[model samples]
Target: MTTPVLYLFGSAAPPVADVAGVITDAQHRGFDVCLGLTPTAARWLAPQLTELERLTGHPVRSEYKMPGTPDVWPKADVIALAPATFNTVNSWALGLTHDFVVGVVAEGIGKRIPTVTMPCVNAAYVQHRQFERSVSELRSMGVRVLYGEDGFQPNQPGQGHPSEYPWHLVLEAAVEMHQG
Candidate 1:
């Protein structure tokens, strides 16, 4: 089976735990999962987050510190950035690539690869003018920016599993790419 590279970017926000469930589900579906974490997210999850790397059999990239030399990343089949933070989104839209997570995005951009960014930020930020512009630019560049059908509300009352994330949508898109 061809391994599909799945890059998952996280933030330190409270939604990280809920977002973790989505990433975990993706791994169970057989994608080679990568946990591209920022400093705060790394600190929040600490070592337990290692489960993703071990379970998916993929090395996690958190820090930008070079280990003598930069390691080359294998070609990615799909890149998904969930819970993309305000800072991260703006940085990517502005082409500011420094941290490991942002660097991965920059490389992915250079490769002309398929990318998905799902921002789970405050509703206010989502409504912000600049944020809307960034989303527009990302969409124009062919990046799939998913705001879910309605929105993601953790522990939402009467929420059923099916009503949560539309993972089937992601799978459908993945299948289309493979078929094409």
Candidate 2:
């Protein structure tokens, strides 16, 4: 069987800096990982973009291609959005596909792609009523949203341990969903 394609998308969060490690981990788990990032995240990782492309053997996309342009990456067998910021989560739940990452994930829902998201937000952001609502909405839509005490528990602002993000849980869920 062909290796599963994992569309691993990330937003501008502290854990995003460790995306290379995540990609490598996914590869070891038998996934052909394609990396996508939010615009701000692309800028944050600009210096490492070339290296990331080499690592994934695919272009790291951050923007939507022009109209009628063909998609570059292979069809995703599973999608995992990690370090999803407050904006990314909210935008996707509301179907605001202004950005490439959010747009693809929103469509993934309709496509019935096995998708999972792990939010990398702090306790302060969680206080916003919209965050919880968005999470609920995404879950109701069949997207496995890994948030709360079971996954990526929100830390207090300024005390976040980005290195400690539960990437394994997200990857495990992706693999499991794909197998099912």
Task: State which candidate has the highest lDDT.
Answer: 2
Candidate 1 lDDT at 79 equals: 75
In model 2, the Cα lDDT at residue 70 comes to: 93
TM-score of 2: 0.98
Candidates in order, TM-scores: namely 0.77, 0.98
lDDT of 2 by residue, 1-180 (tens): 899999999999999999999999999999999999999999999999999999999999999988999989999999999989999999999999999999999999999999999999899999999999999999999999998767889999999988899899999999899999
Regions of candidate 2 where Cα sits further than 4 Å from its true position:
none
Write one digit per residue (lDDT tens) for candidate 1, span 1-180: 776766777765555665456666776677766677877877777766678566656566678756798554556787776567777877788788867787777677778777876665665566667877887777788777776463343333333243344444454454344345
Q: Which parts of model 1 are misplaced by more than 4 Å?
A: 65-73, 148-180
For candidate 1, the TM-score is 0.77
Pairs clashing in candidate 2? none
Model 1 CA lDDT for position 80? 70
Q: How many Å off is the CA of 4 in candidate 1?
A: 1.8
How many Å off is the CA of 176 in candidate 1? 4.4
Give candidate 2's whole-model lDDT: 0.95
lDDT at 70, model 1: 57
